[model samples]
Every structure is written in C-alpha cells, then in structure tokens.
Target: MMETGQVRDFAVGIEDSAIEDLRRRLAHARLPEKETVEDWDQGIPLAYVEELTAYWRDEYDMRRVGTVLSQWPNHLIAIDGLDIHFLHIRSPEADATPLVMTHGWPGSVLEFADVIGPLTDPVAHGGKAEDAFHLVLPSLPGYGFSGKPEAPGWSVLKIAMAWRALMAALGYERFCAQGGDWGSAVTIAIGALAGENIDGDPCRGIHSNMVWVTPPDEVMANPTEEEQAGLDRIAWYRTKDHGYSTQQSTRPQTLGYALADSPVGQMAWIVEKFHGWSDCGGHPENVYSRDRLLDNVMLYWLTNSAASSARLYWESFNSGEMPQIHMPMGGSIFPKDILTPSRRWAEKTFRNIVYWNRLEQGGHFAAMERAELFVEELRAWQRAATG
Candidate 1:
C-alpha cells in the first residue's frame, strides 16, 4: 500500500485533451426543451446552465486550484489495494484532537478547504485558541481523489473502518469524527462501533450536521390533530422532493450516462443541487462565487468521475445500506433539506442521541453550501461530546 504522502497527486489528472473534449461536448450539447417549472422541482434552468458552461469553458482554472491546494500537506494510503487520498493538516498546536472529516456525494475534500485554514489555525484566523485541531479530511472510496473500489462491501460502514485505520496510521490514538450526508452515516457507524468491548476497536465519538429526522413515533404512532396536519405537509414533500433520492438509489447509471457525456449536462445536474440545497434559496451564484462553484464542477470534469460518483448511489441501495444507520450519534437537521426526521424518530436509529440541532438554514450539501456554519456546528458538537 502506498502512503498518502507519496501518492498525494491527483492520479487521474486531466490532460489538455479532456478540456478540449469538455468544450466540444458543451458546444454541441443537445439540450431538451422543458416546461418553465418556475421552481427547482424539476431541474436546473437552461439559461443558468449555459452561463455556468460559459464560465467553465472560458474561465475556470483547475491548475490554479491545484497550486492553492498544494500549500496544504496531503497524504494517501493504499487501503485493501485501493489508494485512499486525504489531506492531513496538522495543527501547530501540539495537543489538538485528531479530527477526521469526510465529504459526501457530488463533493470532495475541496469542500472543506475554506474552513480548514480557520479550524486548524484558529488563532491566526481570528478564532479562539481552543479551536485547534489535527484535521484529516479524506475522500471517500470512489469519490474524487480516492480510488474506486472494484469490489462490493465498500459501504458507508466499511469507509468508517478505513478512516479508523487512517487515524491510526497518523499515530493518533484517540480522535473524533464529523460528517454530513453520506458523511453523517459513516460517522454514525464509527460512533456506534467504537470500543466494541472486544479487542481491536478503533473508532471514537462522532458529530454530524446532516440528519433528515423524520416524525416522532408518538405522532407517527398516534397522530394528534396538529400532528396529522404536519403529516399532510410532509406527505406532500415526499411526493415532490423524494424523486431525486428514488432515481439516485434505483438507477444512478441511467442518470449518470447523460451527465458523464456532457460537461453542460454534469454542470446542470450539480448546479441544480447547489441552487436548491444551498441557503441562497434558488440562486447558486448568491452563496458561492462563480469561480468556486465552477471549481467544484471542474474537479468532476477534470477527473471524469460523474458516473463513478452516481454508482455510489446505486450501490448504497443495492447493498441495503440505509437500514444500517443504527448507532450512537449527534445530528444537525436543516429546514432547507428535503425532509427533517424528528428527534424522536432519529433516536430510533441513533439510540445514544446526545446532541440534535434543528438548524434554520442549510440543506443536503450542507458542508459546501454553508461551510462556515457547518464547521462551527461540527466543532460545537465535538467539544460537547468529548469534553
């Protein structure tokens, strides 16, 4: 297994030909007509997509991004024959907690780049001294720089185990974990399996900022007049918001085929989520700079990972990974997300629920959309749970 520090470079780096290909694909994009949906219920608008494509083709600079990221200390390790990429930013402070943060689908370690400088070196960033950390942001297997797992069994649970090994390799005996979306699920698995009361246990505490808490059993079990009214609202949401999940889980490749082929197709798919999920309401450019948003798209574009990323959606469903979320946990539920699982319902899966946050804003891509808020939320939970 190669050490992360050795293979820290993007293994499948894009060549000039790839850029030409993307431009060609975008130029000849055979866009289909859509009824003006008014809201983002259907998908991204053609106008917005064309603008994003223009920026991508004429302006986005992936090399500049790589150089900026090069300032950080990066590492990778061959885990079970797959090279797992990560950024291990060691705090200047000698006694910081080893905190491992994982990214979710359609996102990369790049998502946390903004907050890492502040989190690890807080005194320098106008934050308190107590905010120090040995941050370990890992690309989940089959995402971004992490090698794709050719085999099955590399589910969320397996990824958590890999992270435990990653922390151990870094010489951290005791550490904490944080995540959102798929990240939340992985961290939950780690916390639940921590200190198994048997030999060879490696996991520690977990803090997550993306839990879609459902309705309480009391309400779900026996609905009151108001609870029944609440159910009606949620039932309507399920009809509208659940389509993406259903498509992602059941037939990711069908969607991926379209996205993987065209840069414009991929941008629309990703940018639509950024728009709908972000606190910007429906305007993606409001929260993120065109450069920043395009950089994220550029990562996928450069690496050519749209299809592989979608396959994760298909695998999660095929492997029956959702029901395995039973674990000790803390969660931050955001109002902007598709569904909010009630604390009562969350406790069914997360038995040792210590901290539950019902945030006013943020959504599915919580870390990327509202990174500063996500960072603070994770830091708050990490302190509360550990101290």
Candidate 2:
C-alpha cells in the first residue's frame, strides 16, 4: 500500500493507434441478425447499432473524450495499492462545501459532466454561491482510467473506506457523499461506518438517486399505491432486466471476453441499459446524444475494462444485509430507475432521512439524463442536512 496523500496530475490521452484500431474493428464488425421483434425487449436494435456505429466510425469526433474530460483538473492518487483517477474541481467560492460524487456501472465521471459547472460554480449557472461545492468525481476502481484491482476484496465497503481516505488526503476533514446504483451501496456504507469511528466523522452526510429498500413485512402486507408500484418495478427488474446482473455476478470473466474484444458488442451491451432505464420513450437518443453515449462507451472500450468492471458484481452483488445508516441521508427516487424505494421503505435503512422526493421524470442515469433536477436535489439535500 502507498500513502494516500501522494496525488499526481493525470490526463485523458488515448493514442492515435487505439483510435485507428477501433475504427478498423467497427468497419469489420460482425453484427448479429435483427431481433424478431421490432421493440427493445430483445435488446438494442440491430439497425440502430449499425446506424450508431456508422456515425461513430465516420463523424463522431475521436478527440471528444479528451476534450470533455480536460475541462476539469484530473488527478491520480494511490490508495490500497491502486491508482484511483479522479477529477478534483474546486468551486470559485472559497467557502463552498466539499462533496465527493460517485458513479456506478456502465456510467463514469462523464455522467456528471453537465452538472459539474453548475455545482462547482453556482453563480455562473444562475445559482447562489453558497450552493457551490468543491467537487471530487472519481472513476470507480476497475473503471475508466483507474487501475483495476489485482486481487479480490475490493468490495463496496472497501471502496467506501478508500473514498474516505481519498477525501481526507485532499484535506477535506469532512465532506458530503453522493451516488446512485452501486454508488448508493458505497455511500450507504460510508454513512454506516461513520458511526463506528472513534475520531470525528469524515462524511458529514450522504445522498443517493437510487435507493434499494425492502419494505417491512407489515408494510408489504398492505402496500400503498406508490409502494405497490415500486414493488412492481422491482419485480419487472428481477424478471425482465436482471439477466445482465446474473451474468456479471456469476461469470463476468466469461461475458467480458466478448465485450472486451468487440467494440460493437460493448456498445450494444451498455446502450441497451440507457434505453431501458432512461425516460426515453423507446430510444436512448431521446435522453442522450449519440456522441455522449459513445463517449461513455469509449471509456470501457478503450480501457479494455469489461472483465474487471463486471468483477465488481462478482465481488459485491450479494452484499448480504443492508447496514443501517444513522447519519443524515437523503434520497432522490427517480421513477424509471431500477429501484425506486419510497420514503417509507427507505426510512427502514436510512434512519435520519433529511430529504426525500420522487421526481416525475428522469431514470437511472439521473445526473446524465436530468442534470438540472439532479443538481437541485443535491442542493436541497445539502440545505436539509446542514439546516
């Protein structure tokens, strides 16, 4: 293990050879036959994938990934024998609160691209200076530019502790944590562990867009309309949308061979989730641009991280029972997300709930699909947590 305080500046620099290789691969892609059905039930349509790949091979700017990520100050710090790549963007406001926002699977720091400007410089985005945050956006281990874990045991709790060490190394004695998807699990762990510390709590509070909560037996016996709808959503996910998780959890290495070797395979695998999980009527482009979607895909493709990233599921999928979070916590439940636990259900695990809301719009990729709403939710949670 290396000292966590040794931070080094890093940059996104994909070589020209890699770009040529990707284009060559896309040109000679072997696409499967179209789905028998016209809808996305079978996964991302073959026609759309062809169309997107054509654009990606020809028109999509190869330099966009570097350009977009270069807007912020990127860095790498050693923690637990891994090089953690993160974007440390400080607010113009000297008194801004420190916040560490995490991303989940099939998502990267790119998910927060639209909201970074607004959150870090509120005045520029027509918000109050007091609402600004000195943001820390990390690429999860085995994802993006971060180093893949060589051994097992880099579970959600371990990642949370690494994040805590990361914040402390950056001189944030106290900070707020925010996340969604797997990120929610990590943030919840941070909140749960804060109570066990003999020293002062490192995390001031935590917030999540995706909260997974099982209603108690009494509540499940007679769920409200919203609760019933949430239950239905859970059922839909487990039955219809959980094949990926099952594969990733049990045999990520086997699945990763295809995803890692073929760019088109990786693209279809991830883009399908964007379409199914987002508020997009039927197409992912309704919520995200072709370039933005490709930008995220490129992270996994360029890094060849399919097996390593999926291994997170293998490591932490059955994370046993949920740890009770006594710290001030907030929930922003998007209806179209995989799980939209109601306040009643969420309160069972998140004891000191400071904020909770169900938005009429948005989905799993809350920050990417609904950037403004996501930012507002964080600001609101901040106010509630502090006030």
- Candidate with top TM-score is 2
Alpha carbon lDDT of each predicted model: 0.70, 0.91
Clashing pairs in 1: 4-75, 4-76, 212-341, 213-340, 213-341, 213-342, 214-341, 214-342
| Colliding residue pairs in candidate 2 | none
Candidate 2 lDDT score at position 34: 86
Residue range 100-179, candidate 2, lDDT tens digits: 99999989999999999999999999889889999999989999999999999999989999999999899998899999
Model 1's alpha-carbon lDDT is 0.70
Per-model TM values vs. the true structure: 0.86, 0.98
Report model 1's TM-score to 2 decimal places: 0.86
Q: Which candidate is the best by lDDT?
A: 2
Any runs in candidate 1 off by more than 4 Å, and if so which?
1-14, 62-64, 195-201, 212-216, 222-237, 318-328
